[model samples]
Target chain A: MDPSEVDVPPLKDLTIDNITDNVKLINSQCPDPRLKYLLERLVQHVHDFARETRLSHNEWLAAIQFLTAVGQICTDVRQEFILLSDILGLSLLVDSIDHPKPADSTEGTVLGPFHTHDAHSEPNGTQIAHDPDGEPCLVLCTIKDRSGKPVSDVKIDIWETDSKGKYDVQYEGREQPDQRAVMHSDEEGKFWFKAIVPVPYPIPHDGPVGKLLKLLKRHCYRPSHMHFMFEKEGFDHLITALYLRGDPYETSDAVFGVKESLLIDLGTVNAEQAKTYGVKEGTKTIVYDFVLVSEEDSRKLREAKAMAAMKHLGLRMKLYNGLPVPEID
Target chain B: MDPSEVDVPPLKDLTIDNITDNVKLINSQCPDPRLKYLLERLVQHVHDFARETRLSHNEWLAAIQFLTAVGQICTDVRQEFILLSDILGLSLLVDSIDHPKPADSTEGTVLGPFHTHDAHSEPNGTQIAHDPDGEPCLVLCTIKDRSGKPVSDVKIDIWETDSKGKYDVQYEGREQPDQRAVMHSDEEGKFWFKAIVPVPYPIPHDGPVGKLLKLLKRHCYRPSHMHFMFEKEGFDHLITALYLRGDPYETSDAVFGVKESLLIDLGTVNAEQAKTYGVKEGTKTIVYDFVLVSEEDSRKLREAKAMAAMKHLGLRMKLYNGLPVPEID
Candidate 1:
């Protein structure tokens, strides 16, 4: 369709009233149909936002500088933009939208910035905490399919900060990984590990994201939680965290990665009971179960939901003279 | 006023529905009241834009990367972000909003990237074009106040590209500034200069902004025009351009800085008239007039208009619990 056919002000002598139209004109020239659509929508929104706030030139300059700093500070090991997104709750929002689980399945959260592909594989019930100064804790988790059947041979990667609230990666002098491990579920779909109870920690705040948090008068503490990634051949992958029930930051997690179902209680077990789990007496024990949905079912559900939402929003999929046209309200 | 008391969704377990609330929460922590208000409005608009487009994680990543590239490419002599803004028509939009001139006064346009603070001061009718290959043109301009009285001793900084459409700064081997001169108006408010007629030229296209233009299927040509910055002790400063009437790119100026009143005809002059103006026979001569408003009057009018607009938008200036509160719609 001719973009000019739409009701828009003249591009010449452009003012705030016609800024969106001028942007749309540029967007219409994009070679890729999907890119064109996305750019057009982006232009409309950005222009509207500027007009609504009557954004000053100085404010816009500040934003540009802030974004530039965020980009310049980023490296292979550091992703400040992602951190910015997480703190603003955008990362979690996107995660939830992209991974809507069934009622009985595990919910997903942010992958965070610390995950690595080199987690050391360990045997069941092996101790992951090499530092003896940490408090001993025993973790036992089960994995199951939607039918309540055990899902064997599944990989579970777990990582967390130590009792002092420092991840192994955060240490400048450390050369080896600490307090993290990868384990395979047993025939019974059960895996056990001995480690220190994870502690609440602040995200690295020396960067632009940290500066932004300080400016916002907000703290950078995330609730104590164990990061878990579960994967198998036929099931959908899950990147989530198990939060301790009583952590002070649980309700005010800086990244907002918490969900009601992800919070679990850690019970104290006596020596005799702990001995059975290969840990000392008075150790904390966490027992939790995770359910997985089939990959095919998950994909179908996501597509169906997205389609319904688009329809509800008055968007239609149609072709206009060989161009893909998204009729949006 | 207490921000929490405002009608907003909870930030916890933030979904797209609560994204704006989370943004507002961050905005509320701003120490400056004006900053707080601006940030809140910005958050609302940005969040709305994201939701309206249903922006994906990958799309967001692409945008972040694009902005980073634009920032990284900027230097003391180069401003890719400003170019991006100009091409997107945002710069012109902001200029128009900030400078609302009276009907009788000359309109303003973009200052562009070619302006420098070190233009060489020259006498009346000085030849600015040192290159012997260029076509000689004579320029005569008059400056006056809204009352039709001549405004003497007004400084006018004039700059333009050479006949080949290359600015002196664009040359890699050139060491001295070319085709630029600063002059003052005579007792009759008349200023004259001899230079080459500027040719339409393309903006620097090797940078990220250029790449974006190509991706948008748009050219990078700006219409041939002479930039002028007029300043007087008691009058508001004016930055504008005088466009050659028949340039092919006049209607499609890449920066959208053109206004109807800025277009002027360059007439051919005979040898006698050209010699009188100290140029060769068959030389082109441009005659134009500019009017300025008093600085004090301009400031008062601008402030009054802004106040009225703010009032009409349901924004009020009041104190809430001893703190300044701007109630915006």
Candidate 2:
């Protein structure tokens, strides 16, 4: 507190004139041996990015607001951020990194924003086409091995909407289970079902994700398709989607779900041929089978293993995505 | 764009599953090879911090909104986020990193959130005491080198307010200049001023930063003090703030601007000493002169730099206490 002590200047002076100094300053906040190196790097890139863009203050504010709205739109039954990721191609990128296909194998496309995992398994020859208004068409298909030989006893779980493009869970006035089904293929590696070829339609668009799409001048429609899971022993079990042909939205499918290998021919059957399947003449039928790669050896974030490892790791668990998950310690 | 070529998957995939992954992903984006390593490291630490906290969606959303508001409040006239950095002790950390103070030297504190580049420079023998009710004071001190040699031609830039604890810009109706001084010390390396002892006061609140302080359960008062800048060649130029002795906010000052070396002694200068400075006899007065070290090179954001670079780097050109400007390429 002495006045005399103030007159003598000390060493270590800093001259700040530009943005690069920020990079250096952030570099100095190193603490924990593990994080020191990381902080130093991020500060540099963040500063560099900001400098390179000359990003205005208002633009930065808008970005923050957009992220805030993205968070506000997330809910128990809806994942608009995930939908955003799907539309922006980030989700597809992640799935792509984890799933690589060999030549002549099933090509994985974008999985639309909605997915349910508790589908009940049905035995072979079960009819899942509950919608009477749908085109009564008999679908015939065979599950084959990579070498093209038929593989019997393959499980084929299928689900699709009715001709009006309304899934069962979506429309309440429709008959119970009218637009959805779960069925398995026969032991002879064949599956037949009676359903209509679904038409492409727009996703629900009253939300922020929808608003963002409109802002980006993009559409909200996805090509109509059916979902399937086909699996057998010693072959890759595939969970895939098969799209119907002659849909105009196929080329510009908003969810980016259209893939060439998944498109099925929806040709009409004659009255004589349709009579064999107990349907009227010129009755158009729709059918498709899914192909999946065996993921038996893929890395899975299983709860059992995670719990066992949590003790020594000092891990803390939180509820996320409706699961008790251990975050990184 | 052809309808027939619709089913296509993207070429590459990326996911930020962990801090290490984030480091790797962000590092690859840095254009400058020199900065790549640093940015990679920073992203790792920031991501690790997020991971370590297991920050919730709501909390992250709050943080994003806070930052957005901070940015939004920042106009060309006022940058609230920078002020936030100053008040939160981050500005000091940045100063520490950029300056690299030697151990046992004076501890550097933050350049408090309000400094105007256009602070009117005062000449020797000019009185800035505009408030008639203030405690009259005479400040006198000599600038010296580390070896105690008196430094000549030392430039002293000083600024403070009247005893009522209000700055000119803060009081809209007063119509008086709370900031009124542009003076340097004499050839004896001595500087002196006569004014009322400034009183401690709360910083201007009512802004969003003030609201955030309330949310964090912190206060907004700053202990009374005067700002000083002293400089000469080859010595460390300093921008030091001195706190008033026995001020109420001393120990628990909100912004953590208290430094032992920066505290001034309130020794009573009798009537005889007061007469020498042209102040009324026995009138209360306080005095302290600050010394500064020589500055090295200063850095600035490159003008016409890439748009992205300007975003983050532009924050540096903001508050120049005292330093040489660096090249902008």
Candidate 3:
């Protein structure tokens, strides 16, 4: 060592030692081989990060406050943070990385937080209930393959909110479960149902998540829509919601559930066809076709079909029916 | 958009008969052009994965519950979830990518959450009052450069719990800070302090974070030790803690802070050296040296560094005369 450079440690040196040593001791307790390596690495980064930023106590406290607010806003019915997750694209990102779909399919979208699996399955074209009302419309739809062939005898689980923006399960007071049903297609993969065009509604604002939105200066409204789940032998099962086009919430639909492909044209039909279809014919009618994508397992489909039969079991499936492949000729 | 496939209606085909016919509606409210494509690819995968695993509602709920529990376990003093992050190897994985510490520098590790920004900065060789009664030991240490040259006149911040594992700040009804002090190094890059060997201690157990560990059936303790944060210009500032090799809690620290490299021997010393220093020379002494790595800036070391520092502000920073680079060459 050069005598000209007499060793001189500064006050900062002492400050550094006060922290580095404890960090070393705490990290040493890790036993999980993987965890130990991870702890050591994390501790170093955390400590270094702290020192670099010259972090202060009050700033740390503010962070704690932000997190506490985030917690206060969460509830069983409203998960603003989860919606935040959707916006950040993390939920869908994780979902995609884990479940890549085939190229030719009716592309799946988000399963908004409002869905409950316990919907009552009804017979083909059976109406679930009547509560509130909107523009009465007829659903004239067919199920088909990519090749345009009819997929016979498919199942469609359907549910929607009443015109007042309330679901059958979300409200409780005067009446029965309104605006909900499950339907099965006939031999030609065709079915028609009676319903009213949905009305857009705001999310439940009676919770902490709602309060948080107010604090953040954001909105909590969703576009009017109906939910559907479709499955059949040898084809992919899909979950999606159909949105009303004219609704102002069509763009900033709060839950981010809109897609161009799912919007159907509910053109005014003459009163004649509405009556023939049980509704007054020529009344407003929306017509669209559902397309199913092929999958790897047909036996799973048969099992799903069977599970649909055993509704008393709370919708339990004895086995999973995978997508059925085409019989390539 | 193929002509032979499902017909792609021309702009003319889309009319204003109803708002649904407006082509601009598809692009505006759903303003993000890429959103549909992304969600389409993601949701299909998520649903298929759920089907493949036959994932049940109960299992899914449990998974979400576990994540919530992890978040609930974090606090200023205890960060079990951070340990979980460490053990999961995510922290180190991030550290590896972000701060590739300059080779030949202090090996970095994870920074557990209980760091304080400002500590008492005392003169070189100041005695830190650990407790009124305990064995006397002299900490003789020198901070040196990479070329074995000493850093003259640098300060070392020192803090350690009493023999019973209690820092002055942690004791109930305590009047003044105990055992912890900010001290400067002499011109010879050397420092000496009087204290008893610190004994192992348990972490605090009276908070929600603690209640969680009890429910999980895990123990809560940390090995006895001292904290040190070493810094100098033309070098990276390091935050580290040394682990007492033989402490009872060595293997079971709840915060997971421990490392073989940071452990010290605290071997027995004779009366002559003790007398030479100050005491009757019969006092026990534990001597150790701190090693720091070189770097450009400590703040930008990692993203988390900025986060931890900004967490608090009023924490103190003790300025020195000036930071002169130690002559390593």
> Considering every candidate listed, which one attains the maximal DockQ?
1
Candidates by lDDT, descending order = 1, 2, 3
Pairs with backbone N, CA or C atoms under 3 Å apart (clashes), candidate 1: A271-A281
TM-score, per-candidate, Cα-based: 0.80, 0.49, 0.50
Model 2: docking quality category: incorrect
Tens digits of per-residue lDDT for model 1, A48-159: 5555445555566677667767767765556777788777776776665556688889888877877767789999989888777777888888999999999999998999
| TM-score of each candidate's B chain against the true B chain | 0.88, 0.76, 0.61
Give each model's clash number.
1, 49, 102
Q: Candidate 1 or 2, higher lDDT? A: 1
Cα lDDT tens digits, model 1, B34-98, are 66766666566555545545555566667766776776776555667778877877667656655
lDDT of each: 0.75, 0.52, 0.51
Proportion of native contacts found in each model? 0.33, 0.02, 0.01
The candidate that achieves the highest TM-score relative to the unseen native structure: 1
Task: Report the candidate with higher lDDT, 1 versus 3.
Answer: 1
Top-lDDT structure, candidate number? 1
Residue-by-residue lDDT tens digits, candidate 3, B1-329: 11122212222111112222222222222223222222232233333333333333333444345444444555444454544443333333333333434444444444444444456677755677656676666777777666667676555666777877766656557555667776766776788777777777655555544543443334555666777766566665555676677776565455545556667777666777755777655565667665554454333454344343334443322211111111121
